[model samples]
Target: DTAVSQTPKYLVTQMGNDKSIKCEQNLGHDTMYWYKQDSKKFLKIMFSYNNKELIINETVPNRFSPKSPDKAHLNLHINSLELGDSAVYFCASSRGQGNTGELFFGEGSRLTVL
Candidate 1:
């Protein structure tokens, strides 16, 4: 079974649209994260939730929101999507609070805006 999975693996739309990506993890982990990969393949953390509590927000735009209903799920919502927002969104999870272990990453959801 897939340890981490995100819906709508591919998204295409015009600018100023609103979109949401859903993620679920079956690994029974306590920490989950949302990461964005730009066109140059640079990965950066956008948000992180530990045990359903927001732990990290990497100065992302207010239009970008992350919701974690529980420890095993984290969802991303973007309002008024811009061309610059087009990138691959990845969902990841870890077993603990610190970076002492491996992070399990999802396949990623590619968002394209024209």
Candidate 2:
């Protein structure tokens, strides 16, 4: 079974549009996170949730929002997409104390802002 899964492996959209991505994990993890890998390969954490509670939210634009329905799922919503938003969005999960295990990553959802 896949440890983590995110929908729409690829996304193409024009700037100013709104879109969202979904994610789920089957590892029974207590924590889930959204990370964006820029074109330069810089990985940055956008948000993290544990047991349906918001835990970490980096200095991401307010246009980006993350929601966790349960410990096993987290979704990202972006308003007014921008060219700078084009990047690979990754869904990850780890057990409690995050550092306890390596972050299990989804293949990644590539968002292309045209």
* Model 1 stretches with alpha carbons more than 4 Å out: none
Clashes of each: 0, 0
Collision count of model 1? 0
Off by over 4 Å in 2: 98-100
**46-87, model 1: which lDDT tens digit per residue?**
999999999999999999999998898999999999999999
Model 1: ten consecutive residues of lowest lDDT: 94-103
Per-residue accuracy of model 2 over 1-114 as CA lDDT, tens digit each = 888999989999999999999999999999999999999999999998989998888988999989998889999999999999999999999989556378999989999999
**lDDT (CA) for every model shown?**
0.94, 0.93
Give the top-scoring candidate (TM-score). Answer: 1
| Cα deviation of 40, candidate 1, in Å | 0.5
Error of 1 at 1 (Å): 0.8
